[model samples]
Target: MAAQQPSEKILVVDAQADSAKLIVLQLQEAGFAAVWARDGEAAIGMLDGDDYSLALLDIRLPKANGIEVLSHIRESGKDTAAIMMTAHGNENLAVECMKAGCVDYLSKPFAMDDMLQRVMRAMTNRRVLLQKQRLEQEKDDFVSMLSHDMKNPLTAVIGSIDIIREGRLGTVNQEQAEYLHAAIDSCNEVIAMIDNLLDIHRFEAGRMQMKIAAYSAVEILRGGTRRFTRIAEHDGIRLRERLSHETPRIAVDKNAFSRVIANLLANSVKFTPEGGEIVVSCRCLKGAEVPWTRLPSYVTVPDGFAEKDCFVQVSIRDTGSGIPPDDLGRIFERYVQSRSGVGRERGGAGLGLAFCKMAVESCGGIIWVESEAGLGSIFVILLPCYLNGTECTGK
Candidate 1:
């Protein structure tokens, strides 16, 4: 790490003029903004309102020891790195100093050059830690604002619109009902986008813990189809299910799988022209029969997976304008929308598919899509069967 920048401040707390004064002089000469405190009380006073990147203190002080000063700084929530200097034969105090939150415990007779190097490294590390903390706080604030300020109000608006359309408030004409439904659908799209953004952030940060359980693949498909039925009807699209007669149970995170289904359906609805058809289907197959070998590396299954492992395959096929073959490989990446200009105009942050991909993969499943320009697309997911399986219907 480089030396602390001139803008960064350091606090030196030691009564010994021989070492403390020389160290302070060297720090300032090395371009660091340094302060001198003759005792522990002075050090704490200096830290009250000012911000310092690092603090160097002596283990034996007049008023308070280095440990006490360090503890006070921590208790007050001050962000500063502490490096304690101990007496020459005070090896026993090394562990105590460290336990009190010192970044480095050094002996009195240490080389000035070595001390400078350690200070520089400590400052660098402290800055990096503070940066990470700021980023995490920003992420939390963003998600909270989206959920409370944006999604909540829009959700209430949608509910009121639904009530009116359902004729609870009064009788409504067909056109009025259609308009209200369209408005509701648009609000739903915004909510889904917000959810995708939050989930994407969590997944990237490795904070999305999946609770795997056996779920009925057929039930999940039916539920998703029901959710988009109204929107599809409004768009003149046919949302049909070609589910199998036998239901297959697959190990997955229920919420994650639901999001995947919703996202795929939304993408289909947005890109499909009027009169287009989308088919939601489920099938169970032997791992060897899944055509997994033909899929790209993005949809890689566990290497331990064998042909004997039974897998459940869920597919959402849309008869809309398909994705360009060249862009198929990268669509699952974050912030990547449709290759066609039409997708851009339709409005999306390009996080839905990426979230779906991660959610599926996190459950030890593989997701892939097959498409060509001018042809419709089919998004497919294959999850390891939870042993209990039933025969699946083919499309």
Candidate 2:
């Protein structure tokens, strides 16, 4: 099969009128839209007036050197790729041109075929870069729109719930009260999901602020667990916790960290079969070396390696239908869903893991999972230990 040829726009800048005209004629003959710039100054003027996909520059020019013109193009941040032309006697000039930001260098004595090849390669690179930038901008726009659209309705629903709960309308009967409570709970869940979206925006914007303070492992777990204990009971799932008494006071953003643990616990209960077990465990580890702490082989550490440090490792291991191996990598991406197996068994927007990931990373910690199909999944979090911080003995 014959391949389709791509049409390109080319800009030619040269001091030699004959050389520039000849190249432009060749490019046009090859079906390129060729724009001519008589000198470096003229090239900059042309760029200011019009957009071109690629620019072919001559190293020797009036008013500005090709390198200077290339530097200007780069500084302008245009996606216009550049090919610098150098006379055969100025081979070193070609290398210098490349260093100055020309995408390709063509020696003056080069064949028309070689010139075309370099121009095509440069244009291809420019096109790819521009496309990537456009896609990223679209992604950012979508996230922003999603955040606003989703949060507004969720805020309204929560506000309505508050009004209903406060008896602003009227007194409620037992059945109405039950239904209102359920409505409030549902509203809270949606609010949490919307908060997840806000968390993503904050994390991406590098705006996640953590308030570091001393907190007790058992106490935080107890309060967080109590909040969700009713939900676990309503679903007939067992929420068990085993905390080490020796678990030291850790430096953490208490409220945010509590959300991390509570989200995981809630997910465990939601996914587990009615009678399944969800175990929450916290222990202080001494000399625990996690993956991120390890230096690559080529890196050598100077002396005074601190050891015997403390880290509070918390795990929410659920005996639920586990995550499939294929869906593991993408589980943390925003709005990404696991399509196969158990993910289909349980319907969700797949935002929980993404939320969990953002929350964990925001608190200067890490969260990951260990799971196998049909076995279970265990989500683990590790936080740095705090020494002699005020304990939350929970009044």
Query: Evaluated with TM-score, which candidate comes out highest?
Result: 1
Sequence-dependent TM-score of model 2:
0.74
Residue range 58-126, candidate 1, lDDT tens digits: 888888878889999889898888998888888778777777787887788889899999888898789
lDDT value, candidate 2, whole model = 0.75
lDDT of 2 by residue, 1-395 (tens): 12224445678998788878889887887778897888889888887777778889888889987888888888988777888888888978788778777778888777888787777667668778889999978877877776788767777887887787778898877777667777777767776776777676777778777787788877888887888777777777888889888888777778777877777886787668888888889997654454445322322222322232567788889888888887666777788765545435544666777877776665556667777878888887776666687422222
lDDT over C-alpha atoms for residue 30 of model 1: 85
User: Candidate 2: where is the Cα deviation over 4 Å?
Assistant: 1-9, 29-33, 38-42, 60-63, 88-102, 117-121, 124-128, 187-191, 194-223, 240-259, 288-308, 323-346, 358-364, 371-376, 388-395
User: RMSDs, each prediction?
Assistant: 6.5, 6.1
Error of 1 at 314 (Å): 0.6
Q: How many clashing pairs in candidate 1?
A: 0
- Candidate 1 segments whose C-alpha is farther than 4 A from its true place: 1-21, 28-52, 55-132, 306-308, 388-395
